[model samples]
Target: MMRSCLFFLVLLGCRTLAADDQPALRVMTFNIRYGTAPDGENHWLKRRELLADTIRQYQPDILGLQECLESQGEYLQEKLPEYAWHGLGRNRDGSSEMTAVFYRKDRFALLQLENFWLSETPDEPGSMGWDARITRMATRVRLYDRQTGRRFTLVNTHFDHVGEQAREQSVSVVVRKLSQCPPPSDEPVLLIGDFNAAAGQSAPYTAAISAGFQDAWVQAAERKGPSITFNGFKPVDPGADNRIDWILYRGNIEPLVCETVDRSENGRFPSDHFPIFALFRLP
Candidate 1:
C-alpha cells in the first residue's frame, strides 16, 4: 500500500509540472487610474480588494500596468505574491509613478530589464520631450519562458494625456529604441499600456501599429466582450469608449483571443480603465 501511494504522489507531481509547461501565454494591460485620485467613495482603500480580485480572476501570465504609483504597485504585489514585478518610476531616480511589468516568476526568467525616458535622450532620467505635459517612460523587459524555452520582449508605457505632439514623438522614440536593441526578428514581442489616444485611430496610435505591432484586438482569431475599454468611476461611459488601452504584438504568434474585462462587483470598479486581456500562442 505504501509503494502504491508513493507512485500516485509522483504521478500527481508530474501532472502539475506539465500544466505549468504549457506554451500559450496570457497577457493583460491595465491603467490603474492612479491611487491618489480623489474618487470620493471609489477611493483606493475601498477598491483595493476589487483591484486584486480582478487580476486574480484573469490570472494572466504577464501583466503590464500604467500609472502605477509605488504604493499601489506594492499593494498589488502584497496581495498577489506569485507575481514578481519590476520597473522604475518615470523619474530621475524612480521616485514616482511607474509603468510596471509583472510576470509569473515560476514560468519566466527575466533576462534583462530597462526603464527609459520617452524623449530625444532616452537615457536621461526624468526627461520630457515635444511639449509633453509630464515626464513619461517605457519599461522594457526581456523574458525567457522556462516552460517553452522561448525568449521574448515585453514593453509597457504610459503616454502623455494632454500633448498630441508629445504622444506622437513618444511613439517614434519607442520604435527606434526597440529597433536598435534586442535580437532581430524576436517573436512574441508585445507592447502594452494606456496610450491615452483614441483606439488605434490617432496618429501616434497609428504609428505604433504601423511599426509592425499588430493590435491584438484587431488580429484576434476570436474576439468578444465590450468594445469600450475605459469607464471612469461608473459602470459604463459611452463617451469614454475610446479603447485607449491596447495590447500590441509582433512575430510568430497568433492572437487567439482578445477582450476587455469590464466587471464590477457591488457597484465598485477596479479602475477607471477596464483591463485588456489577450491570449497568444506560437504558430
Candidate 2:
C-alpha cells in the first residue's frame, strides 16, 4: 500500500510540473528598410542572410516585418521554413511595400489573416487617405497556441514617418478597429511594428496610450538607454536618440522581458532600424 501511494504522488507531481512548464509567447517587430541603402552598396542580398540570422537567434513565435517586398517576403519564408507568413501586395503604384506577419508553425496555428490600408476609408481596402506621405497598411492575424489552448490577435503596421497628420489619423483608425475585435478570451492584444513616432509628447504615442495600451519599455524595471531603435546603420550610439519602433500590448498581459536588439554584428546594422522584442505571460 505504501509503495502504491508513493507512485500516485509522483504521478501527480509530474502533471503539475508539465502544466507549469508551458512556454511564454515571444514576439518581435523589425523594419528592414526595403533592403536598400543610401551609400549605394546594394547589399540587400547579403544583408538578407544577416537579417535571417538575427531573427533565428531570437526564435520568436511571431515576427512582424515592415518595408518588406513580396520577393523579400518569399525569401524569408523560404529561409525560415518553421514560420508561415501573410501579407498583401504593395499599393497600386507598387511603391508601398508589404507589412508581414510570420508565425512559428509548430507552436501556433493560424486562425485568420486580413490586411487593410490605413486611410480615411479603411474598409475599402486600397483607399488612400488625404495626407499622402506614403501609403500605409496594417496586418491582423489570429494565432492559437496548441500548448495552452490560448488565442490572441496580433496587429502589425507601419505609419507614415513624414506625414504627422496621417500618422495621428492612422492611430485613431487602428485603435477603433482593434477595439471592435472579438478575441477568444480577454486575452492580450499585441500591437507591434515601426510606429515612426518618438516616445513622449507625440500625438500618435499619446493617442495609443490613452486608448488603453501600455508600452513594453515603460513596464520594464531596468529600462535603460535612449530607447531609440533607429540606429541609421551606425553602431548603436547610446546618446543619439529617437524611440520610434515599439511593441504595445492590451488586456490582461504582463511583459516579462523587453529590449531592442542591436543586430550590428561585425560593424554592420542589419537594417536602419533595430528590432524590438517582448516576452509576455497570459495571466
The Cα local distance difference test for each model comes to 0.82, 0.76
Which ten residues in a row are the worst by lDDT in model 1? 1-10
How do all models score by TM-score? 0.90, 0.87
Query: Candidate 2, residues 213-238: lDDT per residue as tens digits?
Result: 78988885445435789877776667
How does candidate 1 fare on TM-score?
Answer: 0.90
Q: What is the number of residue pairs that collide in model 1?
A: 0
Pick the lDDT winner.
Answer: 1
Which residue runs of candidate 1 sit more than 4 Å off their true CA positions? 1-22, 237-241
Off by over 4 Å in 2: 1-22, 36-39, 93-96, 222-226
Residue-pair clashes per candidate, as listed?
0, 0
Tell me the tens digit of each residue's lDDT in model 1 across 1-283.
0000011111111112244354588999998877888988888888889999999999999999998898998999999999999867787867888899999977777776778888888878898988888999998887777766677788899999889998888889888767766545856789999888887579887898788889899899887667788787677654345778889998878888998888888888988889999988764
